[model samples]
Target: MNKKTIAAAFVAVVAAAGIAYWSLGSANAPLRGSSVAAASGNKVITIWRDPGCGCCDAYADYLEGNGYVVTRVDDPNFDKRSIEAGVPQQGIGCHLAEIDGYVVSGLVPAEIIERLVSERPDITGITLPGMPANAPGMAPTKTGTLKTYAFGKDGVTVYSEE
Candidate 1:
């Protein structure tokens, strides 16, 4: 088979597997609403993203669904804002959020976001790097674990896994 055919087949297989997993009806399903409890239902998140990015909309929806008050703005200087917010150059993602004085870079899970709020980490914020397949906004394939990194004066470090 050609390369395109093989890649298409692989995607089809993964999609089938994801469907089967979802059929199990587990509340802890990957990429669904995060299981972590909210630190405060009144918390607000302001997301700066490109208006053309559909995944950003999905990410905003995920945050709102988890009790966060989401305000999405299509900022022309999103990259500049992220850099100014202390997001490391390597940790930059498609979108950025300002939450309770922390800069969240990327489609970070609500669980981790809540943990950051509850624990009050000293870091500037957390990032998920490039968008992962099963991340909150991305297409779900039930892939391997997603790594989140914390960035600040101490530099980038593993924050959590989901």
Candidate 2:
């Protein structure tokens, strides 16, 4: 099989798995409302991403496909913003996001983001450093890989094996 074919297969598989997980897990969970802004509802999420990045847009679409109402903010200086907001430089990535006071960076999986927001872990944010092509937005048309990192008071930790 060609590389694009493989990538499509992988995406399909991941999407299928994600849908199954969301269905079984959040099916009955109460949707957080506007009263608590930026909190996960069954419908929405707010993300701050670089203005010119196609990958960020693609990632937003991915979230939307998963039943998330993504509010995208175009920030040209996301790196500066992230640093100012206390995200560690070592944990920097292509994008930065905020959900109910929690931070998410780069090609973070929607499921993991959900876990972070729901659990409200004492952490700065999550990051997928260097935007590996296999990451949600960073995926190459053919083949690639990504590493997800979690930023906490203890420092950056590898959250997922990708």
Candidate 3:
């Protein structure tokens, strides 16, 4: 190939690599809401969710509306991270959150989260399990009840019901 063609090819490759790097790097970056939380002196909660999960975004909004500073991180492997953080495989939620050294999984209500933070339970974390129809991020229809479980070295146990 001519010098100009080779140069153009190299430039294209470099541009593609840069774009890829940026996209991948941003997956772990904190969402824009984090800065607002910091400025308002609210408690910061870092949540890891799968990319393009609208429910997770709604949950974050709920948390923010409830006066918590939410810093969201898009992680495709959020379930794995939740399990690694002491959540059982069966207890994996739509998202994983870290607040006040506690692991909160799924679409737990803000009230329950506040209680968890207030009571300072001895468990490693809490989980709401799978997506429920009437959960905070789900549709606004009341289901029978929602159960939040606490899991640690001992095992999973009923934490609360809402």
lDDT values, one for every candidate: 0.76, 0.68, 0.80
In candidate 1, what are the lDDT values of residues 1-162, reduced to their tens digit?
999999999999999997666433231221221112123456677778887999999888878888887767777677777787789888998898867667889988888888998787899889988878788889633256889999999988899976
Q: What are the per-model numbers of colliding residue pairs?
A: 0, 1, 0
**Per-residue lDDT over 31-113 for candidate 2, one digit per residue giving the tens place of the 0 to 100 score:** 22221444435545656677788989999888887677776777777787777666788777787776666677777777777
Tell me the deviation in Å of residue 95 in model 1: 0.5
Top of the candidates by TM-score: 3
Ten contiguous residues minimizing lDDT sum, candidate 3 = 30-39
Model 1 lDDT vs. the true structure? 0.76
TM-score of each: 0.72, 0.68, 0.73
Q: Over 4 Å off in model 2, which ranges? A: 1-40, 140-145
lDDT of 3 by residue, 31-117 (tens): 222323343555678889998899999888877878876767889988877777888999999999877668899998888887877
lDDT comparing candidate 2 with the true structure: 0.68
Pairs that clash in candidate 3: none
